[model samples]
Target: MKHLKIIALLLRNSLMSHLEYRFSFIMWSITSILWIMLTLISIEFIFGHVNSIAGWTKNQMLLIATVFGIFSSIMWMFFLPSAINITKLVRKGTLDFYLLKPIGNRFLLSTNQFSLDNFPRACILVLIMFGLIDSMGLKISFLSWIQFILFLLIGLGIFYNIFFTAAVTSIWFIDIFNLEDLYANILNVGRLPTHIFEGFTKLSFMFILPVMFVATFPAQILLGTADITMAITGLVILIQDLRGKSMNFLGFSH
Candidate 1:
């Protein structure tokens, strides 16, 4: 209950801060929507020439793209602004202020900068994915819906793990400006089907990059063709990262 109140307070303050600059918010919204359109165009460009890159139809790949957009938007909307920026704050000593507060540092840092403005992209992507799923006439069941919800949660966990790992990496390399870009590029690869890759490429993405689990695996599960091994590997990575002995997971511990 106390934690809930703190979250509510954080959200209220964040919303207040966002509304302080209405024009900037509007411009951001415009650019965000345009970027989504561009993303869809890029997907179309790839599918336009190739009859089928990896046996996935245009709609199937679009579905993956839509899910990726939603995942990306969620990162922007919450994870990046609030938690991922903590590294900069730490380097600047701004985090000292957070440390002095009463709330748990992790919770406060995680929720401090929730951007209501950036949520529209996620909303749009979800709607687009739903529309594509319906148009494709894929038969979905209650069990599949449950699995999809689970996959979404796990995808968010994967996002959280990646972003947190990047931020935590700042404990060692504080001036890495392209940290988010690294994550973005990895996730962008997931916009296409995993099967598009041949031999070693498939193995590399499924394990090293793990982007396939974030978008492709979830879409596959929904489409009734998920690779159980990939899904398990992603989940295991997430769990290990969360409970690992790494400095990031251990919170700057020695």
Candidate 2:
């Protein structure tokens, strides 16, 4: 309950701060929507030439793009800002302030920063997803919905762990900037169907890097073709990553 209250307070503060700069917030929203539109236009153009890519129909590809957009929005809103901020804090030697606080340093560092600008992107992506489902005539069962939600959470966990672990490495290598750009490029790959890859590339994306798990698995679940073994493998990876990172973060905090 205490942790929940802290998170609520952080969110309230973040919203209030962003509200003070209403023009900037509005400009961010406009640019974000424009970018999303351009992305969708590119996808439409691709499908205009080819009926399907890697056996994925236009609607299926759109669904994957929509899912990736949703995941990207959430990551930008909550995780990316904090991850970048941690790097800055570490570089400036101000992370000790968080360490000195009574709250857990991991919680403080991860939750202190928020990007309210991405909220609109998240909403738009969700609406797009629903429209795609309707157009595709997908009859998703309740169990599938539950499974999709679970996999989405697992995807978020996996991403957060990988991202934060990279950020935390700033403690040892302060010059390791541009991690965000590197990860962003990797995430862009998730916009396509995992079926497009073959052999080693597919194996790397499935286990080594696992960017496909971030969006592909959830989209597959919606399409009623999700691989249960793949989902279980992702969950296990997430658990192990979290376990290892928690200990590392605790050591860093002290």
Candidate 3:
């Protein structure tokens, strides 16, 4: 409960800070919507020439894209700022202040910064998802909805663990400031159907980088073609990775 209160306070402060610059926030929200539209337009253009890409229908592709947009918006809202700030903190030699705090450094660092600007984008993506489902005539069961939400949550955790792991490496490589941009580029690939990849590339994305977890699996759940074994395997791998990284962070702080 104490930690929950701290998180609430952090969110309030962050929201207030963003609200202070209302014009900037509004502009950011507009830009986010434009970006999402541009992505959808590109997909539409591609489907104009091909009936289906990798056996994924136009609506299916749109669903995956929408899911990716939501995941991206959430990451930008809650994690991206902190991931970038961690690098700055490391470079400035001020990370120890967070380490000395009563709260866990990992929790503190992850929640210290938030971007409320992406909230509108997340909402828009969700609406778009519903529209896609309706147009596709998908009859998603209640169990499928539960599974979709669960996979999304798991995907968010896995993404944070992977990105946080990369960000914390700034402790050793302070000059690698472009890691966030690189990570963003990699994640953009999740907007496409994972079926487009073959053999080694598919395996690499699934297990090595696990970008598929970011959207593909959750989208699959909605499509009624989810691979439970694959999702479970990815979740297990994420748990192991998070556990190992948590130990590493603790060791570094001490």
**Model 3 CA lDDT for position 123:** 99
Global lDDT of model 1:
0.75
What TM-score would you give candidate 1 relative to the actual structure?
A: 0.88
Better model by lDDT, 2 or 3? 3
Q: Against the true structure, what is every candidate's RMSD?
A: 2.6, 1.7, 1.6
Score every model by TM-score: 0.88, 0.95, 0.95
Q: Write the residue-wise lDDT of candidate 2 on 86-195 in tens digits.
A: 88998889988888898777788889899999999889989999999998899999999999888887778788878888888888888756887967987888887778
Mind giving the per-residue lDDT tens digits that candidate 3 earns over 1-254?
98789989999999999889999999998999999999899999999999998988888888999999999888888988988898899888998898889877778888899988999999999999999999888999999999998888887878787888888888888876697787789788888777889999998788877888888999999998988997788778768756667426547532
* lDDT: worst 10-residue window of model 3: 245-254
Q: Which regions of candidate 1 fall more than 4 Å away from where they truly are?
A: 245-254
Best by lDDT: 3
Local accuracy of candidate 1 as per-residue lDDT tens digits, 1-254: 99888778877887788789988888988888999899789878987788666788788888888887787777777777765577778788787787678766666667777777877777888889889989999888999888877877777766676676667667668776766677677667877777878888987777666667668887987789887776886678667755543334646422
Full ranking by lDDT: 3, 2, 1
The count of backbone overlaps in candidate 3 is 0
Runs of candidate 3 with Cα error greater than 4 angstroms are 246-254
Q: Give candidate 2's whole-model lDDT.
A: 0.85
What's the true lDDT of residue 206 in model 1?
70
